[model samples]
Target: MLDAVVVGAGPNGLTAAVELARRGHSVAVFEARDTIGGGARTEELTLPGFRHDPCSAVHPLGAGSPAFKAMPLERHGLEWLHPELPMAHPFPDGTAAVLARSVAETAASLGPRDAATYRRLVAPFQDRWDELVGDFMALPSTALPRDPVTLARFGRLALPPATWLMRRFRDDRARALFAGLVAHVIAPLGGVGTSGVGLVFALAAHAGGWPMPRGGSQAIADALAGLLREHGGTVHTGYEVKRLDDLPPARAYVFDTSPSAVARIAGLGGFYAGYRYGAAAFKIDYALDGPVPWTAKEARTAGTVQVGSSSREIAAALDAVSRYDRAPDVPFLITAQPSLVDPGRAPAGKHVFWAYGHVPHGWTGDLTDAVERQLERFAPGFRDLVLARATAGPPELAARNANYVGGDIACGAAAGLQLLLRPRLTRSPYTTPHPAVFLCSSATPPGPGVHGMSGHNAAKEVWRHLRARP
Candidate 1:
């Protein structure tokens, strides 16, 4: 019998399997799809030479993840490629506020009015990324914080609504860019702990930078899978587990899936009925004849770009999707230009870009026109450069990945108290009622992003349970 059976071969699932195998535990991972990578997969969705990341492109949290840093993924063919700037938020006036590796350069872009405010905001936790991320991502029982005082200080500032934090900036540039950071998880601007969400992104850029895997996001998954195999962990693709009986008997079962899917497959009816799904994303991948023509020069070089004119506009767009259940007239967009730094992503001189805007959950309307229009606002003639395009709505996304129920990419709603306490209202969110079952999806703590900390944390609990059994 295996020591652990992990269902779903997403980053979290694969990470859990690798961790268990490294610890001398017999482990196996079963994936429903023919390949792994889940949201981290890459494909030639448009033109043959134009490779696109259907879900995640630029990874800030991924580059700074404590879980990934602790592993030797680099030795297994994982190389991070950094852009000239981590991220940029462009305005209609052809000026941009950037999140550069240097805090000073980033603060300077926000304008002189809010430069000091931005500096002061990130001062205390500036150089303590290792301790801060380790403490924030791990569960209390699983690991004690390396620096408790720093963690507490960060929590005090991060626990409030992002709206309160934005008030610190006198100008609109800083507020707008920060608002875009908070919106990354599809949460309302005023949601609790939203401040922390934005702050983390900014700090991540300063620390490790928003880097992408050299070839594409698929490298990250392939590296993890390779490391798992080296440690004697096996992965079986094209296998789906509908019930507990579908998997082989194991000492423990760790799930890297949504709460709804877990309850259904594990036969825990209504256990996750109260679990709410947030707004969906309307994503578009483009095969461009050339790079995106940005009005602001900073956006042309940055790996990630935020397309929203002002803080009010960004807030309204998020509100429209999460609260009003409708698409925003001027959808706020988050775009990435991987080909800017990684030329191998496309053919010679050609580029690949992707943009997505938030929409109501289960929304089926075509958002291509709206998304392109938003892009045209910041990057004029954006449509002229597109050679081909592939679009995915909530239905298409759900069809591709079951965990993205209603196209909520973060897996579950990142709102209210649920933002802090997720999957359930328990101290140990990884554990379920069944002693042998555990969940480690993005639906759990430290919420969403490409970071494998969710799986890292879950493995700790699974190994402990396995140790206790014998």
Candidate 2:
């Protein structure tokens, strides 16, 4: 019998399989879709020559992930292409605040009023990314922190609501940029640990940069699958597992899926009934004739751009979705222009751009007009460059990937205590009531993003359980 069986071939699932195989365990993965990549996949959704990342485009956390760093994914054809600037937050006045690789440049963009504040905020954890990320991503039961002191210091600042954290900045520019970061996870600015979400993104940019794969986001997944095969791990695609009996018998079963999916498939009925899904995303992929025309020059070169006029506006937009259960009139957009740095994503001078705004969970209304309007605010005449566009609402997103229940892309809600103690309150978040079953989806700790740490952490538990049985 196989040592482990991983269901779902998402980054987390594939990473778990690779980790088990590396440890000399026999492993197999079954995927519902014909191809892998889950949220990390790429396709020609708009025009034939314009390759778009339906979900994730720019990856900041992926570049800085300890789990990915431990693997030799680079040897398997994964190449990261960095943009001129990691990210930029543009205003209506055509000036922008940027998250550059250099902290100084980023601080300078915030202007003298809050430059020192921004510098001081990130100073405590500077140059300690390896230890910080390792400790931050791993649970206490799975791994001991390499640097406990730094981790504690970071937690103290990161545990508060982003609204409180924003008070530290004197100017609106600094607050607006930081607010945009917190909104990445679709959490309200007032939510606990929202500060950490923003801080993590900023620090990640400074440490490793927000990068895209040389070709598309799919390269990350293909590399993981290739490495798994090399290690004797097998992957079976187009094989959906509706129940436990559908999968081959194994010593352990790791699910890289939502909590509800695990409960349903594994027959642990109502185990995850309390798990709450949050706001959904209305995403658009554009096959553009040319690059996005940005009023701020920094946005034209940056890999990611935040389109919100002020901190108040960003907060209201998030509040509208997370609390009011309605689409905001002016949605705060998080956009990426991968073709800016990776020309291979499109044909000749053409470009592929992605943008998404938060909406109420299970929202079915069209967000194309609202999304394009927001883009036009920061990137004037943006609609003029679009050759074709593909839009996905909550229903379409959930249909494409089951993990995205109700279109909540972070997998589960990233708010309250759930933000840190996810899936449940237990320290062993990876383990379920059934001793042999484990979960490694983004629904677990360290929350969402393309980082494979969730799978990396889950594999540690599966191997330990396997060893204990024998």
**Candidate 2 per-residue C-alpha lDDT over 1-470 given as tens digits, one digit per residue, 9 for 90 to 100:** 88999999999999999999999999999999999999999999988888999999989999888888888999999999999999999999999999999999999999999999999999888889878988998854477788999999999999999999999999999999999999999999999888989999999999999999988989999999999999999999999999999988899999999999999999888888888999999999999999999999999899999999999999999999989999999999999999999898999999999999999999989989988888988888889998998999999999999999999999998888788888888868899989999999999877798999999999988988988997
Model 1 C-alpha lDDT per residue in residues 1-470, reported as the tens digit of each score: 98999999999999999999999999999999999999999999998888899899888989778878878999898999999999999999999999999999999999999999999999898999888988988854468789999999999999999999999999999999999999999999999999999999999999999999988999999999999999999999999899999999999999999998889888888988999998999999999999999999999899999999999999999999989999999999999999999999999999999999999999999999989888888888988998999999999999888889999999998989899889878888998888999999999887799899899999888988988996
Model 2 deviation from native, Cα RMSD in Å: 0.8
Off by over 4 Å in 2: none
Report the alpha-carbon TM-score of model 2 versus the true structure.
Answer: 0.99
**Candidate 2, residue 109: CA error in Å?**
0.3
Worst 10 residues of 2 by lDDT: 137-146
**Global lDDT of each model?**
0.92, 0.93
